[model samples]
Target chain A: MGTARANWAFLLGYRFYVAAFFVFLAAPLIAAGSFAFNDSLFPALPWQGFTLDWFFNDTEPKLGMFHDRRLLRGLYYSFVIACGVSALSVFVGTCNAFLFVRTDLPAKNFFYIVMIVPLVIPGVILGISILAMASQFANGLEEAHGIELGFLRPGLPLVVLGQFSFIATITSLVITARLRKFDATMEEAAYNLGASRLRVLTTITLPFLRPAMIAAGIVAFLVSFENFNTTLFLVGSESPLTITMFDRMAKVGSTPVLNAVSFFLMIGSGALALVSVLVQRDRTKV
Target chain B: MSQRDIKRLTLFLLFAPFALWILLLIVLPHIGMGYLALREKIGPRQYEFGFGNFVEFAMEPIYWNTLLRTGSMSLLVTALALIVGFPIAYYIAKIANYRTRGAMFLLCLIPLWVSDLIRAFGWILLLRETGVISSSLQAIGLIDAPVELLYNDVTVVIGLVYTVMLFMIVPLVSTLDGMDNSMIEAGYNLGGSGLTVLRRIIIPYAMPGIVSGCIIVFMLTAGSYLTPILLGGKNSSWFTEMIYEQFITRYNWEAGATFGFLLLAFTSLVVWLGLKLSRQTLAGTVARS
Candidate 1:
């Protein structure tokens, strides 16, 4: 009887715990989502009659966020940075995966350990550190060589570089996971059959890595698109969606339009994520 | 080309990009910052090498206190995330129907695709004085008036937990899913109560995942910038904000560099302690990260 009672208690506790967790997870999203359709200027309650004004309203006193040039430009900047970072990180990260899996190097583990340092080190620190390094390098050039490279300035270029530092580690991990699953014997067999190194790579290894590379590229783009902490310090004048949205909320104060932006992001990310998940699921299944 | 020469060339071709990128960006930046951290900045473009910044940080009660506060708060968040996340992870990994597991995992993953700024914004929309929770409580007659809930340590911690909960959950689920079910069944079959079975079998088995999850959550929380600032407001006194103040507001990169290193050192020390306590290796943790 005691054991049965204890079992009942455990089951009840488990159900309650799961229910509360679901609430905790869904509450903020539901509130923010509801505010998207809210007619109220502020994203607070009182059930201001529903209107779609915040999303597409482009007139004075009710200008929608979509019509806001600054916000749109921020989104454009996000795309540019994400594109740059995804390309650079995937290229270098794939190379790293190849080297780590395919070659013997001096202190390979040490290289790996150092490479992943950006993973644990906070993005803020990484941002300022790079800024410091760039400034010092620029100072040296100005004092010694008399050349000032404008690219060193905090801008989109710096934002890309700063983001790529860590995102590259992520890309490498994804590619390397795929790399490790390949049999070395197959490569040796190709080589023994008189295929050139380049032929083996293009014809065999690249095919094996394509799915992972595509997944990594998509993820890298998303990660870069949403990066905030590092970009906050590294960006000069331009703002991405994150920083622009932050400025809107913290500095300019809240608006329902931010809710509209949130809703838009939800739909976009949901669609993209659905595609990526399906692709990844298909790859793993096959 | 000679065979040995060809092999050397191939090796060089394979490694140059990664090696050069790491050296140029990752290694040099920290070295530069370390140099700046060691210096004394007195005037524009004028500096001297010294322990002055470190000394200043040591002397300032505010610096130490903020560090202590941020560290403690991160610990609290990490603990809370573990308690809240473990059961959910267990449910998804062990209890959920096998066919629906993919859907459940995707559900947990969906929020993370949103930016941290937006996630914190969601909290602000809910917890503000004029926000959803307070106004709803009033509507339901649970409160006499709307009481402000924004801008406090609790709110900040909750935001931190919310932002990084997926990080904790992913590792825990991965670890839990890899376990053999028979071991758990064996414990149950041995007349062990549920708690006893969990204590003797499940928790021990999930220790690496727990350690890795805690380390990642703690690192991210301790180093977090957005949530504390947005939710905790001015009195957040978060260490990263101080680093930001020195870097941007004060234009004192010297002090900011020192603070950055301080955060790194402090977090590494804590992570080292966690690693020691859990008997997990850094390499194991890196795989999870």
Candidate 2:
């Protein structure tokens, strides 16, 4: 009876601990989200009544996030860059999936390790290494043959390349996990049924891998959009949304507009995350 | 085309991109960065190859001191995350029902979906002078005046633990979920206390997860620049800040590359030691996470 009572008390204590842990995890985010509607310029307590001026007003002293030209441009640039990164990473990562899984490549273990090296290295190092290589290559070409490569400069193309360098590893992992589950006998059957290699690939294999690829693309897009450490070094003049927010939070104090932006991001990313989870769950059920 | 030709073409197509990706992005850039670090500016248009940049880093007290501070602080963050995360991971893994487990996992992942910038911004809202915590304290008469909580080492550690908590919890949950409740039950049946059962059965079983989670969290905290700068404010004194100052604020690529290499070396060494001590492979650790 004593042991039973002790066990009950322990369980109750454990439950309380877990509850407190979650509150710690969630308090700041909930605070930031709630403050978006606060009428006060500052994101503090004693809420001065709810207002939507942070999201809609275009006038001074209360400019909306949408009306802020820099914020909008940052959002546009982030969207475009995320698109480019997703497309490139998905395509190349698909190729990587095939290379590591399907093809009879020698020293496969070594190559696999090489592929995931980017995943472990710091993003800042990745950015700087790419920057160093590009600048040196550009300078060398100009010095030797009076040639110039505009794409090597810090710009959208470089940003896409830098992001792709690391983001592809994630897409590759996602696609490879799915591809490994694929039954190769299906491909063998396609070949035996007079389907050419290309036809078999396009019709049999790719169709099976389409869901994983789409999921991977979405993951790639979200990662690219939220990326800051690498993009910080690679961005030339056009800052992405993360960089813009970083500048604002570091330089200027918190504004309700930033809170409004945070709320929008939370909703948008929360929805995307839910969709991905559901999609993966459905695939597993099938 | 002949069958052999088609086969050869396919192999070529498969190998080209993989080789190009490693060479152009991973291999060549690192080599270039190393070479840049080696070069010393002797004249306006002339350069010489040497180890002066690395030597300079070693000779500087402030530089190495900041690196040590970053390392020790990162270690603290990793330890705190583990202590804080283990029980939560255990609760989710062992205590929750199957349906609620899914919901709890999603809740943990939600914060990660938001950008780190906004997450740090959230911390600013809660910890600043006129922020929620301070204002609330003032409101309730707990304090006469608001106290600034944003720019200190403790706050930086707290923010970092928050940032990397998900990494620790996911690995911990994945490993703990695989654990059999019977082992824990058996330990209890053998007259072991709860703490003893946890130490003897649970921790040993979850060792790989713990090690992997620690490795990832340590690497992240050590390399992190945003949280330290934002939460630590002017006194951040983080090593990443030094590298950033050299590269961007001062236009000293050589110095920046050297500092970057030192950081990379230190982190790699620690990760290697961690793997060695835990008897875990990098592949297993990374794939599980």
Candidate 3:
């Protein structure tokens, strides 16, 4: 696979590029996490004698983020939204997968292309568009029924919906990747045995799709949990963890405790990602 | 019900809910945004449709310059992601064995799970005036004082390149993993040079993935608001930031809607051009990924 004399220069250059890429990928995460243990107020270098003060100190100078009620509450809101979005996106995205991969519809590609429009559209456009649409719809409902539907305005439900608009699209694509590889002969065999459509859908298609749904569920939850640009304008009185963290970092001049939060978050997502990988690998093995 | 009717009903039921959802949320909202983009508000509760919004964008150099800057910057981000990501994908797919390939593939993916906001903050920790880079240099007596490394285009480019590289790599890995390695070996057996084999065999095979990755990365980078805002600071001239300002800060929905459509248009045009040049179908590229 190489010249008689190995191109040591190229090999070294290639290895260097890969090593540099890995550092580029992992440095910020490692840096952010390392500074969390620093006892200094700022997260810069010259690690001021290591301490767990950021995680537990409740004193005036640097308060432990773990004991912070506001952050925890924001975390709570994010959890709720993530869970709600997971449920919604799973149901909707699974149905979307079935629609694209299973059904016999004219202009199927058109539907798929339209569905994919969201993936490329930025969160800003979706946020403003959803805001404008919801406000308009709420106005119409108010004018027509003399009812103020505050739910249409902004909240967790709206956040979930806004996130779902694209999350579900992504989910469907994930499941469709599986669906395309699926052997339809199983479904045909079930039908040949006089199994009803409902029974076949439940017994054959649903069973086969279970793993994909699980994978998509994890992604849906992660996407919903970390979402910011779309969730920012859509969440009302209840801001999610990302928004709170953004406010603290960009606006309030946050402490190194924010670094501590980033540390915990990196560890947490790493664990969840590990779980997702296991689930995916498990499906392949099965 | 008749068997055919029941079958048709089942199909319809299976598709209708998602169809209606997309119609309501994804499609109509854009239509609303488009309608808003075309109109101008003359007075309170009074509106008129015109090309004034587009004209305003053209009349203002700052608006157009920001648009052009965002275009070039996003293109740079896309190109850098492709350049940085291709080798990693090749390493994961071709060099790594079955046991390690999956693990290496997930390495590129792990960053995505971390939120973009935090990722940007991480860079700020390292690149800000009193940040790690400055402090380390100062420690080594490279410079006497903390240097201003933040609030610049370089920071924004680094942040965006990091943000979108995963999008590029994932598709590349998937596409390359599916490729038969024997083909590359055959090219070698025929005495083709390494660069010749890559240009003729691998690049052609990976075009769909390459194009799809570019489309996704470019769109995400261009539409991105948080990373540029955080890393590039107050003067960061991302077009999405402009759209956000028009809609949120200035309360000008019409102008904001126009910018939103313009952003969408620019991204779609880039994607379309990429697809055309690569001779790839959208469905084929997305399906491959």
lDDT of each: 0.88, 0.89, 0.86
Docking class of 1: medium
Candidate 2 reaches a DockQ of: 0.72
Best by DockQ: 1
Candidate 2 chain B weakest lDDT stretch, 10 residues:
B280-289
Q: Which 10-residue window in model 3 chain B sums to the lowest lDDT?
A: B280-289
> What are the models' TM-scores?
0.96, 0.96, 0.96
Q: Please write out the lDDT profile of model 2 over residues A1-286, one tens digit for every residue.
A: 9989999998999889988888988888888788889998888888899999999999979899989999999999999999999999999889999988877778888788778878778888888889999999999999999999999989888999999999999899888888998998999998899998789989989988888888889889988999988898889898889999888887886688999998988898888877777667766753
**Candidate 2 per-residue C-alpha lDDT over B151-245 given as tens digits, one digit per residue, 9 for 90 to 100:** 99999999999999999999999999999999999998999988899999999999989998998899889989899999999778999889889
Interface RMSD of each: 1.1, 1.2, 1.2
TM-score, chain B only, every model?
0.96, 0.95, 0.97
Any runs in candidate 1 off by more than 4 Å, and if so which?
A185-194, B43-45
DockQ-sorted candidate list, best first: 1, 3, 2
Please provide the root mean square deviation of candidate 2 (C-alpha atoms, Å). Answer: 1.7
Deviation (Å) of B11 in candidate 2: 3.3
